[model samples]
Target: MNRLTIYTLFSLFLFTNCNENAAEKSLFSASKSPNTAQNIILLIGDGMGISQITAGMYASDSILNLERFKSIGLQKTDAANHLVTDSAAGATAFATGKKTNNGVVGMDAQLKSAKNIIEYVKEKGLAAGLVATSQIAHATPAAFFAHHPKRAKMENIAAQLLTTDVDLLIGGGQNHFEARKDNRNISKELAQKGYQVNSFMTKSLDKIEPNYKDNFLYFTAASLPLSVEQGRDYLPLATSFSIDFLKKHNSNGFFLMVESSQIDWGGHNNNSDYIIQEMLDFDKVIGRALDFAEADGNTLVIVTSDHETGGYSINYGSSRKKFKTGFTTDYHTAQMVPVFAYGPNEESFMGIYDNTDIFKKMMETFGIEK
Candidate 1:
């Protein structure tokens, strides 16, 4: 054979030889035929730990509906400067795949800016959305659009939100973005940008036209819908709304984030009831994403936490005394978080990983260059 034909045959042999393992077969088999993901859905159970997810499973009658996914992984959650992680630093790891110091958002440990996966999706002309159960300006959600060095800079973060061209923005924190004592309401600015900004308390979206295309919908409030157990019927409404909007806009593709923001609150306050409810509610959103993926078959769904809050530990002897009780140190811990994934190329999530590795895995699955 000619030298070129020999080289082509050698390359084909190498590719075929690499597909021996079951995991490899699942990921790259000829029948499986890996394709770039058309839809990406990430569910962040902020502050949820193993105990939190377990308790939620119990509360929901032994079903974490989302756990039905075919693949799973574990991730370490240490921050750059400490054993205990803060929200900003923990979230930055997932957002940029780099460890940043506490209080920094979408920046490195030295406070340098990083382009996050959300920005990457936008560059690819994919619809991007952020959904959280906390103020949209909170650490986790703000990381999507705000690139400031300080997570506490709410006003600046609000202004940054106006600049990003995201397809959808849903969550609480009306105070920061709207009329407040500081006489700053970014909702008006977003409205000027042709976004249908809506405060959560407003009785109606009747003012929003049916054909509100390429617009933002802001559910203004400092926090979101109450815990699931407290208002079980309404728990998944926000998640449903966000997912529906993503499907509508992402005819070509989309990336959506659903965050159950209050799990961290319960951990901070040491309130078991609230944590369980939030977790269950968050799981429901995961179920929603799975349903979408199974139907579409071209979507990728990943579920994980930014970090474990409350230093949550469950004592082995407590099952009898408390039907299992949980205690916390009331702060974030460097414990490893669990990752569950489904849809095409979901097997990539298996094995141990650093929190930043999740970003790399997503990039690999979708073939996006770092």
Candidate 2:
């Protein structure tokens, strides 16, 4: 053949090989292994930034509850509109794999409700839940179900709770659900939706027996209970109930979210005493989850926070009589959060990425279509 014919043949060969490679990539992607993680436990330590972890790790008692996790990951907490993220946007990033505006719930930056992991789980017939120390309508918890322009829209957030397909929701803020001053009562509406609402004071577990199953525990309080070290056993009881609920109803597989909300409150209020106690207390539940994962062997446990509060820092002990102190600006800050994961498929969390990446990681690990 002439030189021109030879050149044309070479170009055709290259194009054909490239098309074949693309087809192979798509085929392998569709055939990835399933049955990786039958169950996932996502724990969010709201406002418990990296400094909070360091403080708690050092100042905490002899044992670290989350020490068993074999893998660790770092998360970047920046909102779509701003580098510093409020609770709503940060939590929404974890829930929906999409950066939304600060003060928005489970919506994209456009203020439209986005498909959170919970919603995706529901579509796959997997059970989902939320347990927190703050109001059920709080920004962190609401991001799983509510979408609105402002995080202050508690009334609408409360209403959104009734519409979620969650198998359980337990936390404080009964007031938001009580009809008052033109606001509707969502508690009554939730009951109508087949949820059994129960109340628990700071240390009241008489309503639920240990190992009890088949019931939802709705503990409504004005604020999260003090840590167990602060003499609040009810918080542990509630945590236990949350685990039991997931194990029972979600035997087929489940996604459980537990929040230690007081970390944020203490961070915001700049109370060192409360922050340490609360962090330690939340650590205990992390212990419980670790225990469960070890036995089940088919679960992945993740521990993380939305963002740092109080600008918490560790002033390493120095011999120069120098001291380390934590400082806060009376609001949230633009800082990177820490993430630790254990059990199978936990390796997906090891890279540096935005908070929304956590959502994608979860979906990828669980084989859920985003």
Candidate 3:
């Protein structure tokens, strides 16, 4: 055989062996593929730890929406300046693929701006949406769209929403927009910008149908929303509505974030019953996202948390009927959290990694340059 034929055969042999090797390590493989997801649905159960999930599973008669995921991984949760992480720092890692000091949002430790996945992907004509059980400008949800030096700058964060072209938003924080510290009425500004801004004060979430031609925003409460047990159960339906609206807004693709925001509050309160209620409600939201992802077949669904809170632990003698639990601290812990991925490129999440890698993997899955 000539040199050209010999080179071709050797390349083919190497390629086949590489595939065989990757197939052998399917569970932990990180090899890049040509396939890309048309949509990414990220579900964050804030402050949800293994013990919390266990308690919820038992409380729900030993069932959970998370059981549907096959690809699972662990992630180290720590801040740039401390061993333990707060929600803002932890969320910044996922939003910008970098660690920042606690309480900082969308900016780096040195206070430089970083383009979040939503902002970067929008350049490619992809629409985005956010759904949360907390205020829309709360740390976890706000990190996905707004940038600020501190997460507590709710008024400034609410004002920053006017700069983003995000398609849909469903959460609370009517006070931030309509009643602000700066005395600016952002909701009216949004209306002038052709956004259909509505809230619980005007109509219930179930009754407000978002108009696809205009951007949609719905506030569930005048401020922070109630807990799941207090008859606050709008998360699942809001997630479903967001997916539908974003899909219509951009047929090319979309990114959606659904947060069970109050799970962390339960941890802070050291209330097991509260955690269980929020956890169960979050699972329903997960089921809703999974249903959409499975039907679309082009969507990638990821479920994880920024950090574990309460250092929660399950006690012995616990049964599906009832359980005993304990907490090490009434605050966030320096523990590794679990990562679960489903749909296209799910295997990419099957190994232990840093929290920032999740952002990289999502960008990679969407074939977007980081």
What is the Cα-based TM-score of model 2? 0.84
Q: In candidate 3, residue 98 scores what lDDT?
A: 84
Model 2: lDDT equals: 0.76
Per-model TM values vs. the true structure: 0.85, 0.84, 0.90
Candidate 1: lDDT of 175?
Answer: 71
Q: Considering TM-score, which of the candidate structures 2 and 3 is the better prediction for this target? A: 3
**lDDT of each model, Cα atoms only?**
0.76, 0.76, 0.87
- Could you give candidate 1's per-residue lDDT for residues 1-370 as a string of tens digits? 9999999999999988886864344345323656457778889999988888877766676567866977988988888988778888877887788888889998998888888888887887788888887778889988877798989887778789777777788777777776555786678878888776666476333344323376667673554545555553332666666667776766667888778888998889887777877887788788878887776667789999988878665566655215456565887777888999987678889889888888888776666897
**Tens-digit lDDT track of model 2 for 1-370:** 9999999999999888677763354334334553357678888887898767766777764667767766787888989999999999988998998899989989999888798888888888788888888888889989987777788888777787666777878787777777445666666777777676666643355555433333364765754445545676444555666767777776667888888888888788877667777888888888888887766666778999998888866565622223266675757788877789986678778878888888888887788865
Clashing pairs in 2: 172-221
CA RMSD per model (angstroms): 7.0, 10.9, 7.1
Worst 10 residues of 3 by lDDT: 22-31
Question: Which residue runs does candidate 1 get wrong by more than 4 Å?
Answer: 1-35, 180-182, 204-212, 220-225, 229-235, 316-322
Q: What are the per-residue Cα lDDT tens digits for candidate 3 across 103-144?
A: 988989998887899998899889899888899899998888
**Which scores higher on TM-score, 1 or 3?**
3
